[model samples]
Target: MTAPGSIEPTDLSPLAWRLLRIAAGYEQRAVERELDDILQAHISMLESGSRALSNRRRQTLLELYAAELSPEQVTAIVEHF
Candidate 1:
């Protein structure tokens, strides 16, 4: 899922990438749908680069997406950005 080339300057921001990665890694439609429930226009806006998440939303995304990484794991990844 390392499509670094797919990302452009106007694409997802670092925080958005961190959140989107959680959903992209899983490829779970159900979770994606649930994500929409939690945030308004979250799916389309994120995919279209019309939005980048807040720090709090990013954490909610990882939890909602059931990512393999723990909060510590996610925090470490985020720190690198």
Candidate 2:
């Protein structure tokens, strides 16, 4: 189990990094919409290992990806990136 101030396992996987890079060129709101309102700064911090990924954030991310991108696409990105 996670302790107070401990980071969650879902701290921006490589796939998320790739996605974030791709999303960077788009408007902020678009990324937020796709990423379930997670601020880009939070994502940046998480990617840099300076912040934790909370359980609720992880669930929100999963739901957003599952709803927005296809399972096969997610798998391919995870495998390739």
Candidate 3:
């Protein structure tokens, strides 16, 4: 049994990141410009679940997308990690 408000194991899929990014109206090039260290190819790989994001990168993305995401979406993404 899972606790209330906790993320399910299946919710940890990288697709959440991709969905949130799209919902926030960012394309790969825009995300790359926002995250200087990451290239468009890397963003593509991350969205495709072929790459893993470090904690720092995740935090950066959270901050970047916060303004665009709903409170519930933000909470879900935060819990996903």
Q: Write down the lDDT of every candidate, Cα atoms only.
A: 0.49, 0.53, 0.68
Model 2 TM-score, all chains together:
0.53
lDDT of 2 by residue, 4-78 (tens): 123333644744654644533434355566675588776666556677667687655545544555556544444
> After superposing candidate 1, which stretches have Cα over 4 Å from the reference?
1-24, 28-30, 36-41, 47-49, 52-59, 65-67
Q: Candidate 2 lDDT (Cα, whole model)?
A: 0.53
Error at 50, model 1, angstroms: 2.0
| Ranking 2 against 3 by TM-score, winner | 3
Pairs in clash, predicted candidate 2: none
Give the top-scoring candidate (lDDT): 3
Instruction: Assess candidate 3 and give its lDDT.
Output: 0.68
As for model 3, its CA RMSD to the true structure in angstroms is 4.9
lDDT tens readout by residue for model 3, 1-81? 333234332344577777778778999899989888878887787778897777667666656766687667766654664
Q: What's the true lDDT of residue 71 in model 2?
A: 57
Q: For model 3, which pairs clash?
A: none
Tell me how many clashing residue pairs each candidate has.
Answer: 0, 0, 0
Comparing 2 with 3 on lDDT, the higher-scoring candidate is 3
lDDT of 1 by residue, 10-79 (tens): 3335455545465346444544556654444564465456676564565555555435555554444444
